[model samples]
Structure formats: structure tokens, C-alpha cells
Target: EGLRKAKSRLMEPLMQVDITTPEEYMGDILGDINGRRGMVGDLGERGNIKTISAQVPLANMFQYVSTLRSMSKGRANYSMKLANYDFVPPNVEEELKKGFVLETEED
Candidate 1:
């Protein structure tokens, strides 16, 4: 099937994201990022806000906007763009293999 051919080629997209929040919130934010299989590429502080830049897989980033908003209590802001795809880590791939069954987009 055409889908099989695409899978054989193994194409995916990477994304770069910028997140801003108070310095006190960095630990919670960093934990969430790591939970989503993201790597922090850079981090810095500007006045009262901490800025973090990261690269994450597109698949793992789905519905991330709402999740971030809820986690930060609407105090955080984020932006992201497509970068390039890279192979997923073996552990993450194994976990995803268990399958994701979502009842709705909100899930």
C-alpha cells in the first residue's frame, strides 16, 4: 500500500519550540518537557522570565498547546516551527508501540 511505502521511507518532522515562564516555574516546565521526550536545546533568563528553547518530535507535540496552558496556569507562552526529523529514541518508540487509543481529539 502507499502508506507502507511512506513508512518504509520513514519521514517525520522535528520542531523547535520557545517557551517563556517565570524562573520559579522552570522545574515544572522542564519536567513536563522531559516527560514528552523533548530535549532542551538552550535556556536563559531575561528579567523575571525564563526562556527555554527545545526540539521535540512532532508526534509528541500534538495537543501540547493546551497542556502547557493548563500546566502553567495561563502564565506561559510558546511558539514553535518545523525543523527537521530525527529518529525517535528506542525507549520512546517502544512505549509508543503499546498503541495510543484516543476517544477524541481532546484526549
Candidate 2:
């Protein structure tokens, strides 16, 4: 029981993200980040490039590079650094467990 409890308390990964794109693509980029459960942090620029800073859960960011590239027509560039590991949200944990059960049942 103690082992199960400890396993359930595992940490989740979080990332610090910085995305740069042309001005024309700002709206689409912002909308995409919001849809991915990301929180907008700061907005800045390096010369003509507009940059968005956000922190997003690592799980939710899978395939993000492909999606971002498609959306930007290869014009956007982004980077992420693993910022910390934190507790998984209850809902996310439940969903992950459900997925595991579903996979087992399928097999």
C-alpha cells in the first residue's frame, strides 16, 4: 500500500518555452499555446522577431515541434528547457491510469 501510494505521487515534467515567429503568425501561435494548456508568461523581441515565453507541461508538448513547424510554414523557431518536476494533477493522473488500463485490455 505504501509503495502504491508513493508511485501515485510521482512528479511530472514542466518546461520553460520560448517561441519566436514573424509578426503575422502571432495570433495563431498564441491560440495554439493556449489550447495546449500552456500559460503565457512574457512577450518580447529580438530585432524583427516576436517571441512568446510560456511554461507548459512536458506531456502536453509531445509532437509540438512538428505542429509548430506546420503552423508557421517553417518560419517559427522555439526552444524548451526542463525547468522542474512537479506533482501530476489529479485529472491527468487519472487519465494516464485509464489509458494504461485501456492498452492492457486491448492486448
For this target, which candidate reaches the highest lDDT against the unseen true structure?
Answer: 2
Error of 2 at 38 (Å): 1.4
- Would you list the clashing residue pairs of candidate 1? none
Query: Which pairs clash (backbone N, Cα, C closer than 3 Å) in model 2?
Result: none
Q: Which portions of model 1 show Cα errors greater than 4 Å?
A: 1-11, 91-107
TM-score of 2: 0.79
Which runs of model 2 end up more than 4 angstroms from their true locations? 1-8, 101-107
Please, what's the RMSD in Å of model 1? Answer: 5.8
**On residues 1-107, what C-alpha lDDT tens digit does candidate 1 reach at each position?**
46445664344588998999977778988998888778899999889899999987788898988888888888899999998888776666545544532333347
lDDT of 2: 0.88
lDDT of 1 at 62: 89
Q: State the lDDT at 43 in candidate 1.
A: 99
